[model samples]
Target: MLHRSLPIRASLLLAALCLSTPAWSADPIHKETVALTAGKAAHSVKGQIKGYATAEYTLTGKAGQTLSVKLKTNQPSNYFNIRQAGQDEALFIGSTSGNTYQATLPADGEYTVQVYLMRNAARRNAVANYRLEMGLRD
Candidate 1:
């Protein structure tokens, strides 16, 4: 009886896991560096991602400075997140908070900006054409 129930329990666990939302930090499929003009503190970039694809942008910033990010996309299911390098959790979740993010730096180092579509949209092979604006100010 114990051995028979083991398979049943494993199947149930698998079902539960499949029903949960996907982990927000999917491995990015694209990467780029956010470059600022010689004297400028802000810049805007455009790109497109589809399905479960993700684009990551890295930028360097100093502690005590403020970082601002705005994402405008063609699909409402598209979103972005911000995280410091070597971190697993995100500092901002666009799907829950909104498309814009603003926060003061926590340390002086590199940060990543990730853009992708929600699972619901990604599973449907939806595409997101987006303009991402970023700035850092003292």
Candidate 2:
């Protein structure tokens, strides 16, 4: 009887551990496309994000081209992350507390920029209305 109870306890512990994790751990990520013209382009997008919601934008350019990104949010705790398309990890772009990112593409393909609210802020049931500006230089 004691051995049977041990297994039940372990199952409850595992369930608790999973529930305590952050919502962003598996939130749906929405995607958008950025259009470039004449080897250069700039765009501004506006939207609202609630809780742990995430959004991503994709653009294609040649290798060695420069990309500039800026995010302005109504909430101070919102920021953006840049990563290569088809990848799951974000690139380390200096301090992770800013709304701006700049880098050169390592290869010629689609790159993704992710916008999300900070974890601490998201937990408080916060919402952010933001504008994302992007520029690509050829």
What's the lDDT for residue 105 in model 2?
73
lDDT of 2 at 40: 52
Name the candidate that leads on TM-score: 1
lDDT of 2: 0.79
lDDT of 1 by residue, 30-64 (tens): 99998643236579999999999999999998888
Deviation of model 2 at 48, angstroms:
0.7
Deviation (Å) of 91 in candidate 1: 0.7
Deviating ranges (above 4 Å) for candidate 1: 1-28, 37-41
Pairs of colliding residues, candidate 1: none
Give the per-residue lDDT digits (tens) of candidate 2, residues 12-118: 99999887966447766778988865245478899888878888888777788888888888898888888776667776342364777777877788887778888
Q: What C-alpha lDDT values do all the predictions have?
A: 0.88, 0.79
- Model 2 residue runs over 4 Å out of place are 1-26, 38-41, 86-89, 92-97
